[model samples]
Target chain A: MKVSSVVWLTLVWVLLWGTFTPLTLVGGVVVAVLVLWVARQAPSTDRLPVRPLRLLALVGYLVYDLLVSGAEVSWQVLRHGPRACGAIISVPLLTSSERVVTLMASALSLAPGAMALEIDHDAGVWYVYALGPRGASDVERTWLRTMDVQRRVLATFGTPEELARVRRLIEERVA
Target chain B: MITDVVSAVLMLAGALSCLLGALGLVRLPSLLSRLQAATKPQTLGLFLVLAGTALRVDLKSAATLLLVGLFQVITAPVISQIVGRSVHRSGGVRPEVLVVDELAEERPQDRPS
Candidate 1:
């Protein structure tokens, strides 16, 4: 059992209860243990190779994107009514890492204008639902934007080898 | 005084975001688009409200509010993903609204009845 998982789950339990009583703490530990024991799988032992500066950059971009997209969507709602254009463009995945994919999808979903509808990690593609990408050029732009999101995610959390792999993949695509 | 003013601004902005989210829910044509409104703006609104509340509260309670925001951020996307997937699978979206549907084209066999 990963101590960190136990500790994190227990913290969640305590927070949910909104109490730090001894009984609450004990109950949290017991519940965490039971959950972990029941759902026993190969724990991911790899420590995340987080690049702090890159992670900060990713976060900053997400926040800005969120605000801008939110305003854009809101304006669209008021001005355009129900006639807004929606598109589902599949973007090729750069890295096949599950964690990176999950993070990228979540970040994309959290921003207002785009949401990932389906992720085929095995196929190395994400089917993303985007607002306002209408024509062939717009779809291509949206595809590149999704790839950019994936690139930021890879840079922030990927190992050095994985980062190099992504760079190579991009270069190959360009070539 | 400055803190109060800032907090009020944050809270008001949060409220406006929530209103817009609700408006989108009613105005948007499709389920996926509605889900976009339901999840995204509401999330930002909640976060802003939590931030404003954290600023006004004592340190300990502020920590709790921060946890609330953290949990919301972590879980919101998961919820949206599940719902979005279901909608996509069930063909809840109108074809006219979608300019490009690569998912349907890419995996024709996976289409739901």
Candidate 2:
């Protein structure tokens, strides 16, 4: 585990304890180290190359999407009654990085109407359950929106080579 | 006074969001849509409530509230995903209501015999 990961875990530990005394801090550090040592490493164990600016942008977009979709879903629930139309669409992603796809899945789910049901990493596809899209056109739009979400996630967390590869795939209509 | 008013508004909105979520539970069409209604607005509601509380509380308590919000944001989606996957696999999702179900053919059981 990286030192940064250890520090972050310790911070979370202290926060969970709701105290910041020296003893708590020391205990948190020790526990964090021990947990990291015992825990199996995450599937994609490479250090995440996070671009702060892009990450901020991605976060801002997610928050905006979340609020807007929340309101939309709320309105749908109140207005649509039992006749609500939904769809399940598959979006092909450019990158197959497990970590980035997982992040994208979480973000998509948090956006309210669009919930990621399954991620086929080998095929680089996400099967998303979307609420309240009506016709074929609406489903197509949802698919495109999901692709955009994947692009933003890739931009934020992916390495430069991954980003370039995605761009190339987009250009080739492969993604 | 302004801060207090802002906090009150935030809390009220949060409560309203939660109410919508509960209402959706009773009114939504299926398990998946209900899951959407259950998790998303409730998540937004919780965060809004936490924001309101953070404004009223001291720094330490506010930090704890921030932690609560972070964990909710992290965990809610995961819970939703697990439930949704299970629902899909178990034939809980009604295909008649869906306009397009790309995942329907992905599972052998879901395919037409």
* Number of the predicted model whose DockQ against the real structure is largest: 2
Q: Which ranges of candidate 1 are over 4 A from the true structure?
A: A17-24, A45-47, A165-175, B109-113
Q: Candidate 2: TM-score?
A: 0.92
TM-score of chain A of each: 0.84, 0.87
Docking class of 2: high
**Two-chain DockQ for model 1:** 0.70
Model 1 pairs in collision:
none
Candidate 2 lDDT score at position B53 = 87
Lowest-scoring 10 consecutive residues by lDDT in candidate 2 chain B? B104-113
Model 1 Cα interface RMS deviation (Å): 1.5
TM-score of each: 0.90, 0.92
- Give per-residue CA lDDT, model 2, range A4-61, as digits (tens): 8789999998998888999889999999999998995864555578589998999899
TM-score of chain B of 1: 0.93
Tens-digit lDDT track of model 2 for B1-113: 98899999999999999999888889889888998899888988888898888889988888889889899889988999999988888778888778988888766586433
Model 2: DockQ against the native?
A: 0.85
